[model samples]
Target chain A: MHTVTVQVVRPIGDDIQKKAAERSAVLLLGCPQVPVQTSIALYLLSMLRKKGIKGIIAGNPAARRLVEVSDPDHHYVGEVIDIDRCVADLAEKKRDFSLCFAFIHNDAGVSYAATIGSLSGGSLVALIYGEHPEDVAETLTVPCEKIVVKATHNPMPLKNKIDEVLPWVVSNL
Target chain B: MGCLESLKYEILLKNASSKESGDFIRNHYDEVHEVEAGYKILDKHLIGIPPIAVGVEGDYVIFPYTKPCYGTFLVRVAVPEEVERLRKRSK
Candidate 1:
């Protein structure tokens, strides 16, 4: 009779701790005047969550409410934080995010993205969308990855871009 | 910082365009933050940089008021409602 002995190796100490330290990402969204932007944001939130990245939505009161109401189950989104405080904290280095995705559709969005990209020492992607996303992208002078798609009423283009870029973003993290 | 003054009018300096005013505010203020379009400062939406310096001294909310031809002026307005809203939002 031949007996086989098996040794099971369990990850301990640093290895387990490293795996437990899940990376966090912040979705910096602006006040969307159109419904499509909100739709795209929700889609992106789902994708981020599926990728195992903890996503925090930072925006104004209305924008925050939009996400809260849309994702009432909290299935895809995490804590909804104030964008102003988020930016201040990032600048002060009090809060550090592994990745940042700024949904830029207007000038204010561009400014927010530029500010966050400069402060956040992580991968930053300026997802520019709307009527003339190119125009909005031009104002984003900060050196960061950008995905500009003319998607005001249609969410397909923006959604596709997100799908394409998400893998690269996760790899960077 | 003294007793609250009962002034109710806004001071607008329209000596510069919106872009120029925004640039000026960004250059001048070290801690400027972006406010949404409909945010009430002095019973009106600020036209300068979306990001503006908001300071509180006593019961007054000090911010930059900008108009096309009037440029930008660091005006303090006594609007407790708006001030309270800002305070709440910041938290």
Candidate 2:
């Protein structure tokens, strides 16, 4: 696992000790044209919440709507945030999350994952799914824990990888 | 006003491929940022799924605009606000 050293500047007399407190994890989902990505996101959200982590989902309107519709009861996730704004905030250091899981199925997904991985002061899991996941993974140059699986119709391969990584992530957190 | 809403000036170059547009921007502009397709530019979602070049030229911003069935076009729009925002983010 590659570590990222993020330098956060705080106001004087601020609660510096709170830096070690529980920070949130963001799941950056790509705008999926298929149904499988939504299913995988739902699974990831449930697992993250179960682990007692403040999990937030960020994506475009389409992706957000898909997740929202799937979890109509809002059991897995609450409000779905806008991915572009989230990226901008992360870049400006206006927002901070401890861990990030960017779902990559296209080149744009890779770029988003790399940008978030480089900006966030946390661990990034570049979960590359869909057909030819390796092609998408190759574009991700940032150093982060990557789980590449060629599973577009079925989410088992990626789910297994997530299961293996979640324990380690929670323990470290 | 928002960047897209305040498009006072625009220069569109037709028959331009993604690589050609990227090269044109790189050769002309001093600062260039590679943004992926589907990413938003001033709240406007960029089309396509490949990475495109967004370059800063003085107070203007240059990026690719793709239309389905039609080829990619290089669009140079004067949006100083977006230029400032991009500068801050790039820093």
Which predicted model would earn the best lDDT?
2
The collision pairs in model 2 are none
Model 1 lDDT per residue over B1-56, tens place? 22223465454334333345455446754544456432446434443333544655
Where does candidate 2 stray beyond 4 Å? A1-21, B8-24, B27-59, B64-74, B80-91
TM-score of each model's chain B: 0.57, 0.78
Tell me the TM-score of model 2: 0.71
Per-residue lDDT of B38 in model 1: 28
Query: lDDT by residue for model 2 over A1-173, one digit each (tens)?
Result: 99999999887646533543355789988757645788888898788776667788898788888899888899988657888778777756688888998887765576567667766788988888877888768767778888888888877888898899889976776
The window of 10 residues in a row where model 1 chain A has the poorest summed lDDT is: A13-22
Which digits, one per residue and each the tens of the lDDT, describe model 1 over residues A3-72? 9999987657767445435778898877667567678778877877777677888877777888889988
DockQ of each: 0.08, 0.12
State which candidate has the highest DockQ.
2
Candidate 2 residue-wise lDDT, B1-91, digit = tens: 4666476657567755455677788888889977654455665545432455788888888877543223456777777887888778778
